[model samples]
Target: MKKPAVLLAVLSFIILSGFTPQTGIKPCYLSLKKAGDLKAGTADRLLADADKTRMLVTEAGEVPITVTEGYRIIYNNKKKAPFVNLIVELSKPENYEQDKKNVLANLSYLNAQTTGMETTGKLLELDYNGYKAYGLSRAGISEGETLGTFVIFPGDNMIIYIYFNNIEPAKGHFKNAAEYQGYRNDFIGQYTAHLAKCK
Candidate 1:
């Protein structure tokens, strides 16, 4: 299947029953550009791409989920492909709390959805600035290239997903697991700090 299809399949599993229609004032999209050494794409372009992706996923008929409110931003380096991608999905406050409590269960469900093309590493439990978080490292099964780390955490009424991919490993961002962990941690800290200012 295509990359979007594959991504939708995985996201379908992660968000199938996790989001509910929320009423009242919607959260505003964060105005963030530079986080650590990463720079983001234009807000309009990122939002348009996210909307297109959502429409495609909804029309695919593979999943019965609809992302009513969210934002997707691609953080790039000098490379063409994004080095890190951020997805902020809003949910009801109650659902957010529940999801936070059941993060492990959710991660297990996500792990089961991984296909033969991808191999997932051990789940890394994290305390992201006092917010409960989890990280899963994934790579291609054949090439063994570092795909990225999927770092998940809960916000007030939203779920934050940070996909940290070192597309330009030749630039010496990270060479091994330990180095990757350090790099991801630094990025997460900087990114979350930016998020703290978001309303």
Candidate 2:
């Protein structure tokens, strides 16, 4: 398959798998109830707004998963809520390595494709639920004035990406660097809890 096609396939797999990864346990679909119950207040607040479906259409094709949904969150007293969408897929890393060389290569390609990028953090390899994964931070790539993160969890046959962005508020984005990192850490902690509860 072409590079893009293969990428899409891998992405599709990640999206289809939900948070269960490819472990022995069955994967669970995400929902407003599950998200709202999470100790992560921000996450609960975000998902509390809606319980809807999403269309995962890619050049490779589409994955039919009705549980996918979107939500809006009001941050820093902003009146306009940013629309958020979640896509889940299930697939394995065809060339995953201990040092994450494959992921680094892919990140390089993504960085090149990105324009107006202000900054990007180093890619860190970490484990989630006994599964090897990679996480990175970035900013200034979006022209829509969005600030957020991108995380990838590479599993045996499940690669999950969490794309989160918030529209720039009138007062500006996060209060400061510390505030941003705090939110990011909270998000990761809550997300891990949600995944555990789902299974």
Candidate 3:
């Protein structure tokens, strides 16, 4: 199969197995009730907003590259809310080691992708419900900066990226850096635990 075709297949598997709405089965990602203080937004709305800002090539010839947004949880569900976005991307290489290296490279590329934002702090290795994952931090250069924690888990032929960000910290939802970190960890733990149960 072509690379795009393979990617589509893997993405289809992920969506059907985890994100799709089905009778009696809860989704693997975070939900409105599970988020507690955070409010929920539809993935379709998030994708639409993203489409306005960036062009996403969904198809190439006969094959389609599916970009699935799992759960979009935010503070107050406002237009400009502190949010957590979950997205899955296809791994370029078939080999696990090469794919892992590519994931790290992609994380580094984030620093240069945006003019005012930079990926900062050390990349930490983590265990998410028995799956190996990596987490990195990001910050905006300007004042009233955005603080974010990005985590990725490499799967069979896909990588799951979860980004947690606070766009406006002065609102005082999180008292300190440690409080924000705790919330991020709890959110990740809940998500991974749900996935494990589904499996």
Candidate 4:
């Protein structure tokens, strides 16, 4: 129930997990913010996650999928190898009604032309703190060489949006993805394990 306890639990999870990130280092934190931020308390809920992940038709023949994931690593297949670590995916179809409708429609149209690309319907998912997350992406789309990715943190007090390439594009500081597992565990999955919620 306490933040410290939660922080410990998250650290334990990361360390105990069999698979280690590339860095071989584990993060330790109950929430995204540090102790000071937790004690201060901040506003919660900015743009509430979409009520639903549905279908919408887009102008182009391409159908874009919308979804979320806990501690997910989106990699582009075309590049050299590991692809890029997506921080914040802009134009994530943030529009509520419009985005939902367009995403659904695009899915159908794309399905007809491509195979193995059907919306499996919540294929990979994670729901925590009344917040449900899904992930959306395609294989061939190019991510360019991210060579970028520093810190992927939360905005406001509600969401953790990862944003890289702040000053430059395609070229930015690199944040070892392996080091963030601890932060992911505590922040994501089930409940607010580390940070103290507003009283």
Top-scoring candidate (TM-score): 1
lDDT of each: 0.55, 0.41, 0.51, 0.33
TM-score, candidate number 3? 0.54
TM-score of each: 0.58, 0.45, 0.54, 0.26
Off by over 4 Å in 2: 1-29, 32-80, 83-85, 92-104, 111-121, 125-133, 139-149, 154-156, 171-173
Residue-level lDDT tens digits of model 1 in 1-199:
9999999999998797578644522344346777666688864322433431121121222232233356677877654457677776655554555444454454545555555323354466656555545755553322334444454554445566677664545654456656666766776776666555554
lDDT per residue (tens digit) for residues 42-80 in model 3: 542234334211222211212222332223444442344
Ten consecutive residues with minimal summed lDDT in candidate 4?
35-44
Whole-model lDDT, model 2: 0.41
- Clash count (model 2, backbone only): 9
Comparing 3 and 4 by lDDT, which wins? 3
Best by lDDT: 1
Candidate 2, poorest ten consecutive residues by summed lDDT: 36-45
Which candidate order results from sorting by lDDT in descending order?
A: 1, 3, 2, 4
- What lDDT tens digits, residue by residue, belong to model 4 across residues 117-137? 213442223355554433322
Q: Against the correct fold, how does model 4 do in TM-score?
A: 0.26
